[model samples]
Target: EPEVTQTPSHQVTQMGQEVILRCVPISNHLYFYWYRQILGQKVEFLVSFYNNEISEKSEIFDDQFSVERPDGSNFTLKIRSTKLEDSAMYFCASSEETLDQPQHFGDGTRLSIL
Candidate 1:
């Protein structure tokens, strides 16, 4: 079965720097999402995108964060002015056709901020 894939499985960055995480969700999925899990914490929803527009976003997704589907197959999450608290395992996910479906997630991009 096809699965989501994230680039740079691990990333180390300085605090206040910018970071862009890349993901390629399942080809046939229609709903895409970005989530993060701080070490030893539960996964938290960040944002969701569908049909080229943002469907929903959580409080954690502030002006500093953005999501884009630059092309047919690539979806990305960009965090501007990264903070130490932003360090977490970022995950990309996709659902077949609706939010009700189970989302398949990538292995995750472990971000480390100093």
Candidate 2:
């Protein structure tokens, strides 16, 4: 079966540098989302995108963050300035629909802020 894939499973970054996490969602799915989990916190939704525009976003998605579907198969999340609080597991998910579809998540990109 096809699955979501993420790159650089683990990354260690400086406190103020930029980082881009990459993901490739399931080919036929239309809804994509990004969520982050702090070491001992709940998964927090960052943003959801469909039809090439943002569908919904949470307060966590601030000015320093951005997302893009640079190509037909690749989705990316960019953080302009990393902070210590940014250390967390970033998961990329996709589903056939939002209302009742269960999302499939990648193993995740574990970001470490220094």
Candidate 3:
């Protein structure tokens, strides 16, 4: 049973600093995604990637956000600038086959922007 792993269990940064969140799914997966949850808000879809390209993205994924699969097993999300409102738990997920398949999620990285 493989799983998705996220780095920097927690991050504390300035409001304007750049942040990179990394995830590694220990399986031959093709679909990857990034989601975020504010402390008291719902889980919001950020972006999805396949074939080394963005397959779907929510409005939340603006010019400030970007996703990349820099390697075969690793996917990353970079925030050009962190805002105080951006503080939340970021989750990385991957599906072995397609978007219709179930996905495995990481423990989530709690980002606190001050």
Candidate 4:
């Protein structure tokens, strides 16, 4: 079975610094997405990518944040400048065939900004 994989199980960064979170789903997935869960808060959708472009994005994915699939294999989210409020658990997910299929998610990457 194909699954999603994420790098950096945990990260601690200073405010104003930059951090990149990475993910790799199976080769067949046509959709990719990023979500964040602030401690004690519900998970929120950040962005989604498809066909080499952004398919959807939430207000949280502002000018300071960006997502990319630099290679066909790795999906990445970059924070231009970290902020204390950015601390959260980031989840990467993918659906192989279509939205009807269940999304496969990676064990989240926890980001901590000081």
TM-score of each: 0.97, 0.97, 0.95, 0.95
Q: Per-residue alpha-carbon lDDT of model 2 for 1-114, expressed as tens digits?
A: 999999989999999999999999999999999999999999999999998888999999999999999899988899999999999999999999999899999999999999
lDDT of each: 0.96, 0.96, 0.92, 0.92
Worst ten-residue run, lDDT, model 1? 95-104
| Candidate 4 residue lDDT tens string, 33-105 | 9999999999899998888899999999999999999997999999999999999999999986555788778
Summed backbone clashes in each candidate are 0, 0, 0, 0
The segments of candidate 3 whose C-alpha lies over 4 angstroms from its true place after superposition are: none
Better of 2 and 3 by TM-score: 2
lDDT of 3: 0.92
Q: Which ten residues in a row have the lowest lDDT in candidate 2?
A: 48-57
The collision pairs in model 4 are: none
Candidate with more favorable, higher lDDT: 3 or 4: 4
Off by over 4 Å in 2: none
All-Cα superposition RMSD per candidate:
0.8, 0.6, 1.0, 1.1
